[model samples]
Target: MKMEPIEINEITGYWTFLRNIDWRDPWLIGLIFFHIFTTTTALLTRNRINFQVILFLTLLSMAYFSEPINEYAALNWKIFSKQQYFDSNGLFISTVFSMPILLNCMLLIGAWLYNSTQMMAQLKSAQMKQRSRKEAGIATEAKKTQ
Candidate 1:
């Protein structure tokens, strides 16, 4: 029997769509929440390299312990068996190393870029204020001498 993949559009919205979800698996739900939390945290944080590293590690760990990956393996056991590829643990281990590393790098780069822009804007504003103050002082001095 052939199986149809779940359409992304089907689950694209609010919590009301929970009624349509067939498998109420806790692991799957937890993993989804974990990913959301880590990704959101990574994005919202400002200038915290250590926090980014921690979040990246959390995301990577989530991939290894992901219920979705296990479910997929179970559903396609035949395909997995046909190949000489390692078992579910192998899948988890491989993901633990790769996906998290990439995610961490991206988060770090984004944070760096964002912090740089903010600093540059502040510096420009300060400079402008100082220039204006100096000009006002010069104008007042000229008027006093006139």
Candidate 2:
């Protein structure tokens, strides 16, 4: 007996692929929480290396070693009956998986830098206002004594 390959529609294939993702995975949940924590802390507190390193490692693990990637690749093959694209076609499966992780890493760093700059600007503005107030107070006292 011979079996024929089933052709997959783009929308249905993607929907099935998304459904196959294991949302219940504890590590993935933890990673989600970690991202939230890192983003909030970076925005609220002084920038630090430890948090950045942890975020990088978590993202790296998700991109490279997680079960979701392999599952997606297998599902792609099963649905399409062909090898997943790796630069052959305009669409690359692995790129789609990794781009978000890379973009988020850039965003984390950008957020930290932006927050730090804003804090510094506020500090400088406060210092200038305080200095101006002190000088004005001293001038008033001198005029009264004269």
Candidate 3:
């Protein structure tokens, strides 16, 4: 028995549909909110809006969608193995399981990149200020000697 793969759109739609429902697993909802907030922070602080972040956002959203996927799989997916039936998590772990892990890792990497960019920008500004001060000092000395 083969488990049907959940479509990314379906996952998104699932979240949308459930958004109105107050009843939800707190653990899953908390995870979703945390990822969303952190990813958004990364996007705002990111130095360059390149294709890489775009791809990362795509995957991040995909990760957001997986909560529904897990729910659907638990309720709907039926795979037969001997006398016992294992769920979707039993097989194709990489495609399904790895998605959320990748999402979390990407969020962390994005945060790091954003913070590094901010630090470098600050360093550059400081160097400019120091150079201006040195130039002013030299000019003042030249006038004093004259």
Candidate 4:
């Protein structure tokens, strides 16, 4: 007796879709590498100017490529409004696309906070040093007068 093929329903189909993704695709690999490089630079760079430049470039690139990336994802995942087979594709695509953006924004905010705190600490130290110098000068003048 001949056996029939199993029909892929919503539950089983998603795993199949994920498994079928072409890991060897050059565009996908490039995108992965780019994100990695940018994320590491954002995390490790000590120079504020450099960090700002990298952040600007990253945002620019994302804006320039957003439409193409969305189209590519939709094509690969067969995401469509009419199809009920993979309703989760919208969530999946949004998550995949937004994660890097969210990460970079968080990093930028963290860097800003760190810089502000450092500046405040430096200002406090300078003020303390100036106050000490003024007190020492006043004491020396009083000794001279006596």
Candidate 5:
């Protein structure tokens, strides 16, 4: 059997590539809905630990399923030619997979920093109250001894 090379034109720009994405793909749709659900839950939940756990799971799922997601994108885009696939795969992966992960990581980091700061403030307040109580006790003891 003989194989013939298939020709593929260069992808124009980010918008064009995005426009070509197959929104109907089950994997893509599922990921989108899952991400939305995670984000909503993270926002609504008061527990910082819960938010962190959800974000971690979301990131893990995104990383694990990236291959299948990219495969679908490639098939949808019809980039079957070896040279074309290689050339475009990086863009596909970055746009479809890495971008979401990066954005979510940023959100996770922001939430961590915000929660940490709030915790530190709380600890400081508690320590100050304890120190004041100790000082008051010491003053009372000195007065009794005098």
Candidate 6:
């Protein structure tokens, strides 16, 4: 039997290609949960460098490795034969995977900066309460002195 060179669309149907937008795809949506799970794991284990490193590495490896494997299987098996996806074509999915991890890292570093905005409000309320307490304590102090 002779072989045929695969044109991109031969691998994926054009109609299948047009069907879903980024967030609507099943895998991309599944990735949202993956991101949240991985992000939560990364956040909860702050004391151990090894755990954080391992989790981050796991996320990286999944992005770099698991995604390609998934795509290959889908294409080869004709699971997604209706749509063609190259690693490059999947820029959207790749972005989706990266967003949560990137945001988690940034949130840790930026949360304190954000907290500063509220710091003055918190301190002023606390100070006002303390001032009222001190003003009201004059009678109690006189009784103690007596």
For all candidates in order, the CA lDDT equals 0.58, 0.58, 0.55, 0.61, 0.66, 0.58
What ranges in model 6 sit over 4 Å off?
Answer: 1-24, 70-89, 98-146
lDDT of 2 by residue, 1-146 (tens): 11332234432665554444444445445656765765565445446667776776787777665345556655565454333332323233343446556666777678767878898999999999999999999999999999
lDDT of 4: 0.61
Model 1, global lDDT: 0.58
Model 3 stretches astray by more than 4 angstroms: 1-92
Best by TM-score: 5
Residue pairs in candidate 3 whose N, alpha carbon or C atoms collide under 3 angstroms: none
In model 6, the Cα lDDT at residue 142 comes to: 87
lDDT per residue as tens, model 5, 1-146: 11223334434777765665655656667767866776665566546687577767778787777777667756664443222232345676776566767677677777778888999999999999999999999999999999
**Which 10 consecutive residues of model 2 have the lowest summed lDDT?**
1-10
State in Å the error of residue 106, model 2. 1.1
Tens-place lDDT digits, model 3, residues 64-122: 66656655655653441111112354333233344555765576576767778899999
As for lDDT, the candidate ahead, 4 or 5, is 5
lDDT score at residue 128, model 4, on the 0-100 scale: 100
- CA deviation > 4 Å runs, candidate 1: 1-33, 47-50, 53-97
For this target, which candidate reaches the highest lDDT against the unseen true structure? Answer: 5
- Model 5 segments more than 4 A misplaced: 1-10, 22-30, 46-51, 54-58, 68-88
Q: Could you give candidate 6's per-residue lDDT for residues 1-146 as a string of tens digits?
A: 11232345543654433343334546656767877886676566655556666666666666567567646754674453333444455653455555566666564445444556678889999999999899779878988999
lDDT of 4 by residue, 1-146 (tens): 11222234523655565554454545546767877877787767746666576685776677556666666655664332222222233443444455666677677678878888999999999999999999999999999999
Model 5, poorest ten-residue lDDT window?
1-10
